[model samples]
Target: MDKNELDKRIADLQAERERLTGELDKARTEARDAMIAGQKPGGTAAALAERLSIVDDALAELQDRTRSAADSAERNNRKRRAESALEATSKRSKLAAAVDEALNALASSWDAYADALRKDVGQVSGAGGDLTAVERALTNNRAAEPLVKALIQSGGVKLARTFGIDTPIRERHAISLADAENRVAESLRVELLRVKAESPQPNVSREAQAELEKMETAR
Candidate 1:
């Protein structure tokens, strides 16, 4: 049962008691009117007393029923309150469990992201030695000059355009590659740390704790 249902029951009982009281008052009034009417002929005091006694007894019975209804209403109200409290506690416990799962998932995702960043940085760094060797090979061969110049011109133009650099061809290529590599490394490090920092910590809401206590009491 819920509070609203209990309140409705109490209201119905009160209304019924009021109706019974009204009926009892009406009965007493009718008895008095009868005695008054009887006074005209054979209006014996004994007859009047008997009619009044019956009215009194009926009124007492109605009063007893009214009292019994009030007591039942009070008991229902107490039961409803206890049930409502128990339900609220159960809901809160379920909510807390959901929150705990969400936090654990978030932490797991952050850890995975950090691991991926570390792998990406390692792959990029492994290419650094190979890139340096290519630069050295281009620098030392004069007989291979035309081929090197053609390669530089074609690659430099594309690299410069892609990187948004407007410098001399050789300088632009070198600067763009170094800058891109450094930026990737730095970005990976920063993002990994940010994910670690944003990971959820252990904590619980006060309302959730209170609800848990209520559930324990019910058990």
Candidate 2:
């Protein structure tokens, strides 16, 4: 049996022993009271003693078995943990390799990238986002998982910089997925309001536009 099962059995045996002990004590008291009063006792003190002894023997044997089971269970648990850690580490390496492969493939497809860049009319600027929480989370495994995942999925060329795998993404954004989503949404709404104000369409009624303005004001 497993350690937990063994422990439960041990607990049950101990409970039974406690119950028997209480009964045995009451039996002895009754027998003593009857002898003092010069009458036959109703108590079965000998039978109770024999039952208690049997329980004691069983409890002792089960406790010894549990000690060995506990050690074996602990060893097996650690073994699984060690094996799982190796697999996790291997997968981590594979993930990094996959990212690198994607980067290399992108570099190979340079003509499309050049065309997109040349056609881009957007202004260039740094994101200047705060990285305080991300930096702090690095030392903590539980906290870092989601943070690192969000950073990778945020879709920047210099994700390596966030984890110190490469240089800093200077003049570039180092934002998590949630923050990136918020920024994209906010930027789009602002542009929508500006366009609606500049050239009011038939569909963009005054009341609808007022709600957008209200949202801006609330923020």
Every model's TM-score: 0.30, 0.35
Candidate closest to the true structure, highest lDDT: 2
Regions of model 2 farther than 4 Å from truth: 1-15, 34-47, 90-219
Candidate 1 lDDT, tens digit per residue, 1-219?
344554555565566556556665666677677768884333344454555566556556555666777788899999999999999999999999997897698469645644554465446445432223123222332322222333445565564455354444363334332343455555455444444445563233444445455545866
Q: Residue 182 of candidate 1: its Cα lDDT? A: 51
Clashing pairs in 2: none
Q: Rate the local accuracy (lDDT) of all candidates.
A: 0.53, 0.64
The number of the candidate with the highest TM-score is: 2
Q: Candidate 2: worst 10 consecutive residues by lDDT?
A: 121-130
Model 2 clash number: 0
Supply candidate 2's per-residue lDDT for 95: 100
